[model samples]
Structures are given as structure tokens and as C-alpha cells.
Target: MKLKVVLRKAYDYVRYDLKEIAFPSSLPDPPHIKKRRKLTWEERYLVLKEASRLYAASWVRDIGPDLRPNDYKKYDDGEEKPNEVNGATKEKEPSTLEDLAIAARGGMETLKPALQRVYMTRASAYRDALKSFIEGYKEGVQQVMEKKENSGTQGEEDSPKKST
Candidate 1:
């Protein structure tokens, strides 16, 4: 719900910006797919592992851009057999789904009010922006519902959100 609203607001802003754009683009276009620094196997594994952990933690499944920055490790020893020591002596506490869920809920509860205040205190512009965003979202949803009602399919299985 929240991300959908955010994206719709972004789309609205883009359309508004395009309409208000001053000097038009004049530069020549660049290549379609710019090259990026290549990742090693260790980096790839770390990324996949972190994403898996985050997906498990998300109650509403709206984890935004990496809230934590990561560094790349150049090399990694290949996978090891279970219960075998390969010179790494540290042990980590194993967490289950229940533990992760509880932790995620705790994190959200602690962060929600602070996040609200962050928007509220930025400036008058930010305050009004947030209000307008919420109002616009409500109007859009109402219009969608009305259209759905007229179409005769109040499909509970259908939500307007785009799934990745």
C-alpha cells in the first residue's frame, strides 16, 4: 500500500516536471547498458544471503533500498562441509523464523513514530508534500474501487500493487 502510493506520487511528480520542464534535452544519447564493476562469487553469495534474510524479516514485504551499505570481498574460500572447521573459530547464534519475525516487529514498532516525525519536521514544504501525497493516494484508490464496482468484480484476490 505504502510503496504503491509512493510510486504513484513519483509518477505524478515526473509528469508534472515534464510539463514544467524548461530547456529541452539536446545532448547525444549514451550506450543503453553502461558497464558496472563486476562482482566476485563472494559478493554474489553475500548479496543473495542478505536478500534472503531480508525477505524472511519483512512482515509487509516492503524492504526499501539497502538501508545498510555493503562492501565487496575480493575472494572467498569455497563452500565447506557442515560441522567442519576450516580455521574459522567464531560461532553465531542461530535464529529461526519466529525469532526473525519478532525482531522485525520490534524494529518496526521502534522506528514508526520516529519516521513519522522525520517527515513532519523537515519543513512546511515537506509537510504539505506528505499531506498531498496521502490525499492523492486516497482519491486514486476511491476511483479504482468505484470503477471496480461498476465492472461487477470486487475481486479480493486482485490488488493494484505491482509484484516484483
Candidate 2:
């Protein structure tokens, strides 16, 4: 084989076997890259609050197979119409909350829309409700933390720890 052809084949083989390649130098920082900074105490609280709200709503979404997230709070299970339960007929079809709990556990298949009647309406309502819950829970946690901090400072002044 010609020298050039032999070299080309070897080069092609190496290239094909290589799975990845690295730049000769570091690439530019991504435009969307964010700085690493600790969140302020309040921001941390808000983060926790929001997480809790999302978690709560996600659980609520697990209602019956027919139920959607929107109706999780309002839909009544058909059991109320008179369905046999545990060996006997129960009173209600099962409240929205009950269905959700069951659904979360993999009992139900779907949920009906309770409040999200329309498109924009549902998106807006769900967004607001999640924000509200997050803020409320965050504030509650902050209040408790403040109370504990205050009590601790006062305790130090009023009755400092002493060696036995």
C-alpha cells in the first residue's frame, strides 16, 4: 500500500475508536452559569417552603385513576353511591383527600379536575397556591427559629451553663 494511504487508514482507525475529544484549552463559561453563593437565611427558608408545597401538591395529584390534580380537593369517590368496602358497604365514595392518599400509594389510576376548570385558570391558580403555601410554611419556620434563637440568647444571660 502507498505510504499516504497507509497513514490515512491508521488515522481513520484511531479517529473511529475515539469516543470523546477534549479541547486544547478550557472553554468559555456558559452564559447561563450562575455564581456559587450561599442563600440568605430567609432565602433558604423560602426554598424549603416551596419544596414542601410542591411535595404536598404532588401527593395530592395521586388521586383516583379518573381524578386529575385540580379536582383532588373536591372530587368525591363513587364509593359514596354505595360500594362494598372491606366486606361491607361504606358511607361515602371516599373524599378527595382519601383518594389522593390511596392514589399516592398506587391504589387509584387517575383524578378529576376539581378547581382547574380551564387552561390559564388552572396554571395561574396552581402557581399561586404553590407560592402561597411555600411562603406561609417558610414564614412559620422562620418564626419558630427566631423564637428559639431569642430563647437561647436569654437563657445564656439568665442562666449560663456551669461546670459541675
Candidate 3:
């Protein structure tokens, strides 16, 4: 009884509600996808740098005053490696749009709407920009490490050693 009455009411509501609205025979084609403007290398670099700094600041802010800038250095210097000294592998931490938005918010109520708007408006582009920046950064670091190791080996060969 009550169940039948509820089902009938729902069906009537949907049927009447749908009839009141006008729908074209064929739905209009979806809006064409626009080509997004490309960012220059410098612009992308800046975006990545700013994003990193903003995220780091947000982390510190979330932790409150007990944590300081120097304390964050450990995170900056440590990279996840399978063969770490203790054989413990480090886990990679991924950041999301919400995390970025919260960091960019800086706890200001007035900024929330603008932050959300920008995030929604440009999230894809921003994500790609960050991706490129991080890839380039990793490549640079690897090259530097290779160079340092090569120099150290060359120095050892060039230096005189006592023979037993």
C-alpha cells in the first residue's frame, strides 16, 4: 500500500515534470573543444616552482608553528630509493587539486571563491605544467649526479697514491 502509493507518486512527478520541459528533436552538438594556449619554458618553470613552494608552505601551515623551514629540508633532500641504506623503500607522495587549492588558499575566506574558480578553470593546464616541470627537474638532478660521480673518479685517478 504505502510503497505502491509512493511509486505512483514518483512516476507521476517524473512524467509531468518531463512533459513541462521543451526538448529539441536532436540535442545541440556539444561546444567544440578550444585549443589551450601553450606556456613557454620559463612560464612553466615558474609555475612549477611556485606550485612546489605553495605546497611546502601549506604542509608547514597544516603542521602548525612547531615545524620550521629547516625541518622541511629532510624531505627536500630525500628521494625514494629501493636500495636505501637501511633497505627501506621510500613511498612517493602524490598531491591532488584539493591540496593545491588549500595551499593556495592561505586560510583567507575572501580567497576561497577565486581559488576554487581558478582551480576549476585551469586545473588541467596547471597539472601538465607541473608534470613537465618535475620531469625536467628530475633529469637535471640525474645529470648533475652523473657529473659529480665522474669528477670524483677522475680526481682519484689523477691523485698520487702510495703503493704497498
Candidate number achieving the greatest lDDT relative to the actual structure = 3
Query: Which pairs clash in the backbone of model 3?
Result: none
TM-score of every candidate relative to the true structure = 0.20, 0.27, 0.28
Question: For candidate 2, lDDT tens digit of each residue in 42-100?
Answer: 99999999888766766763434343545434436653422224555434477656755
TM-score of 3: 0.28
Pairwise TM-score winner, candidates 1 and 3: 3
Q: What lDDT does the true structure give each of the candidates?
A: 0.68, 0.67, 0.72
Off by over 4 Å in 3: 1-121
Pick by lDDT: 2 or 3, better one: 3
Ranking by TM-score: 3, 2, 1
Q: How accurate is candidate 2 locally (lDDT)?
A: 0.67
Q: Tens digit of lDDT per residue, candidate 3, span 38-129? A: 99999999999988877777765355333455444333346643324553355455445655566566766646765676677688888899
Q: After superposition, how far is residue 13 of candidate 2 from its true place, in Å?
A: 90
